[model samples]
Target: MTPEEWQAVLLSLRVAFFATLVSLPFGILVAMALARWRFPGRQILNGLVHLPLILPPVVTGYLLLLTFGRRGTVGQWLAELGIIFAFNWTGAVLAAAVMAFPLLVRAIRLSLEAVDPGLEAAAGTLGASPIWVFATVTLPMILPGIIAGAVLAFAKAMGEFGATITFVANIPGQTQTLPSAIYALLQVPGGEERAMRLVVIAIAVAMSALLLSEWVSRAIARRIAS
Candidate 1:
């Protein structure tokens, strides 16, 4: 791969890493809420969390632009604080995180739903606070699911293009990720080879993440079982 291609790969890895990392905590919280709690506006929250998945990527990007652009409502406020997302790599991270959030939440929520409530109640009866019970008893049992969800979120972030490009404008070496780079390359003649190479790289990276997630999750499960 060319140097530019390599840059895109590296930038993509960086963006996906941060995207998954930043979103994981929120995903877990949201998942736990959706799975374990009954509250007002629960369905609304769930729908909002999954809206990116349901809406067109372009629309999602446009909304991000309106909300986080330098002159945007939230963006203008953030810009005053010297934190900008418009046309920057950080914007790519935000875009990827938002786009991949639903998958992460879904995976973790399923796992949470599958967990036995009695285990948590037992811990509570033993004088454990809700937070303590979750941290000590519930969290460990959901380790594999968390791993799976994070990996899936990372993969989704790696492949995000439409929202990313629309929000960040595909600035090479700054915001051009693997998917955007591939898309850019396809726009011109004699670019197919490079595009194909990037495509292969994307597929390889995604597959590696999945396999690693599976291996790690199985290892933890076996250890827990034993």
Candidate 2:
């Protein structure tokens, strides 16, 4: 691979890492809410969380552009604050996060639901506050699920293309993630070799992440069962 290809690979890793890291807390919270809390508008919140999974990637990207573009309602206000996203690497992260969030939330929620409510209640009975109970009791038990969810989100971010390109425009060395780079390469004459190289790398990364997540999830399950 050439220097450009290496740059794309590195940038994709960077973007995916950040996207997963930044969204992990929110994913965990939302998973907890969906798994345990019963509140008004719960169904609506669940729908919104999973909206990206249901919507076309292009539409999601376009919506991000409209909402984060300089002239956009939220974008205009954010611009005054010196934060920008549209057409930048930051926008790629935003797009990737949005697209990956549903998967992250879903994985975490599944794990949370599988947790025994009795354990949490026991912790509470021992006088642990809700926060402490979650941190010391709930969180430890759910670590594997969190890891699995984060890996899934990271893998999703790595392959994110449609929303990323629409939001960030695939600027080389910046927003030019692996998928974007492959797409850009494919458009040119004799770009197949480079594109194929990237394709292989992307598939490898995604597969590795998935395998790792599965292994970790199973290992944790076995440990808890024992």
Candidate 3:
């Protein structure tokens, strides 16, 4: 692959990594809330969490642009603090995170839901504080789910295109990720070979992540069972 292709590959990895890393804590909290907490507007929160999945990618992208663009309500305010998102690689990261968040939350939520409340109640009975109970018992049981959710979110970020492009404009070396690069190559004549190369790389990265997630989850489950 050429230098530009290499850049795209690296940028995609970087963007996806940061997007997943940054979203992990929030995803965990949101998942915990959805799975364990009974609160008003729970359904509304759930719907909003999964909204991106139901909406068109382009539409999601457009919404990001509207909300985070340079002149946008939030964007302008953020820009005052020197935190810009519109037309930047960081914007790509934000876009990818938003697009991938639902999968991350869903995976973790299911994992949390599957946990036995009895175990937690027992810990509480034994005088463990709520936070301690969660840290010791709940977190261990839900480790596999967190791993799976993170991998899913990473894979989703790797392939993110519409929101990224709309928000970041696919500038090379700055915002051109793997999917955006492939799309760009496909639009030109004689670019199929390069596009195919990227396609393979994307598939390889995604598959590797999934396999690694499976292995880690199983290993953790076995350890927990033992």
Candidate 4:
């Protein structure tokens, strides 16, 4: 592989890693809330969380550009903190995180919903605090789901192009993920072979993520069953 291709691969991995890591805690919290809590505007919050899944990727990216773009409201405030998202690698991470969030939340929520509340109540009766019970019991029981959600998010992040490109234009060695790299290669004359190689790489990454998720799910299930 060329140096540029290698750089794109490494950058994609870095962005996806950070995106998944940063979103995990928030995704778990939101999933738990949506699964177990009932409050005003819950439905609205759920809808908003999932809106990105339904919206056009370009539209979502544009909205992020508007809200988190340097000249935009929140973007300006963040810019003052020496954080510029637009046209940068951080923007790519943000776009990937946003695009993957819905899948992560849904996987976690399903797992959370499947957990028995009676177990929680039992723990509470045993003098276990809510936080303690969640940390020990609830979290362990739902480990498989968390892994699954993370894998799903990682896969989604790997394939994220529309939102990522729209938010952070394909800059070599920076925001150029495998998918974006493939797209760029496709646009160039006599670049089909390189594009094909990248396409294969993308497929391999996605398949590995899925296989890893399955393995994790099975391991967790076995542990839980034991």
lDDT of each: 0.95, 0.92, 0.94, 0.92
C-alpha RMSD values across all candidates: 0.8, 1.3, 0.9, 0.8
Candidate closer to the true structure by TM-score (higher is better), 1 or 3 = 1
- Clashes per model (N, Cα, C within 3 A): 0, 0, 0, 0
Query: How far is 34's C-alpha from truth in model 4 (Å)?
Result: 0.8
- Candidate 2 Cα outliers beyond 4 Å, as residue runs: 222-226
- Give stretches of model 3 more than 4 Å off: none
- Residue-level lDDT of model 3, residues 22-104, one tens digit each, is 99999999999899899999999999999999998889999999999999999999999999998888999999999999999
Candidate 2 similarity to native, TM-score: 0.95
Tens digits of per-residue lDDT, candidate 2, 147-171, equal: 9889989999999988898888988
List, residue by residue over 1-226, the lDDT tens digit for candidate 1.
Answer: 7899999999999999999999999999999989989999999999999999989999999999999999899999999999999999999999999999999999999889888999999999999999999999999988888999999999999999889999999888999999999999999899999899998989999999999999999899889889
Q: What local lDDT score does residue 196 receive in model 1, on the 0 to 100 scale?
A: 94
The weakest ten consecutive residues by lDDT in model 3 span 217-226
Candidate 4 residue pairs in backbone clash: none
Best by lDDT: 1
